[model samples]
Target: MEQLIIQLISGAVGGNAAGSAMKNLSLGTLGNTIAGLVGGAGGGQLIALLGSGAALAGGGGDIMGMVTQAAGGAGGGAILTAIVGMIKSKMSS
Candidate 1:
């Protein structure tokens, strides 16, 4: 639960940051956030499936595990946002 929350927040931040960094791939704030949330959830589940679930959600004091999860979520969010942006640009063009 805590890990999920952490991932979600980090994913949102990552999405916004990526959007700002890549102007051509930037989605509006709301779009980025929505994409980030979905990506975050997906990423968290992916990480769990990859066998990191126990380490991440096992102990309440597992800071490093939480950080790792956050990183995964962030990366997922950024990647998904980029993909969506590319598709949108292509469709518009």
Candidate 2:
């Protein structure tokens, strides 16, 4: 549950950052945040499925594990936002 919350927050931040970094792929603040939330949840599940959790656990309670998880969430959020934004842009054209 804690991880989920972390992912959600990081995802929102990541989405906004990505939108600002690439206007061509910006989905507005709300859209970006919503997409990022979904992506973050999905990405967290994917990481669990991929067994990356074990690698992180090997560190035995270190900041790196938390950082890695946050990064994963952010990356997932940004990727999804960009993809959706691009698709929307293309469809509208």
Candidate 3:
């Protein structure tokens, strides 16, 4: 639970950062946040299933586990945000 919360927060931050960096791909704040949340959950689960985040899944309270989850969430959030932004831009074009 703690890991998940960490992931979500990290994801949101990542999404916003990406959005700000890529002006052409910037989703509004609300959209970025929503996408980040979804991506965070999915990414965390994927990492856990892949065994890289097994410690987090196992409910470990270690700092490393939290960091791993945060990394995964942030990457996922940025990737998803980019993809969505590209798609949106294309569709509008």
Which of the numbered candidates is closest to the native, going by highest lDDT? Answer: 3
Model 1 clash pairs are: none
**Clash counts for all predictions:** 0, 0, 0
Candidate 2 — which residues are off by over 4 angstroms?
A: 55-62
Residue 24 of model 2 has an lDDT of 92
How many clashing residue pairs, candidate 3? 0
Q: List the residue pairs that clash in candidate 3.
A: none
lDDT of 2: 0.76
C-alpha positional error of residue 16 in candidate 2 after TM-score superposition, expressed in Å: 1.1
User: Which ranges of candidate 3 are over 4 A from the true structure?
Assistant: none
lDDT of 3 by residue, 1-93 (tens): 787887788888778878888989989998888778777777776787898888878977877788888988888787788889899999999
Ranking by lDDT: 3, 1, 2
Per-residue lDDT of candidate 2, residues 10-84 (tens digit): 778787788889899899999999888877767755775576754454545556656666777787788888888
- Give a tens-digit lDDT track for model 1, residues 1-93: 788887788788778777888889889999888788778777876886787765876656577788778887888788778888889989999
TM-scores of all candidate predictions against the true structure: 0.89, 0.85, 0.94
Ranked by TM-score, top first: 3, 1, 2
Report the lDDT of model 2 for residue 55. 49
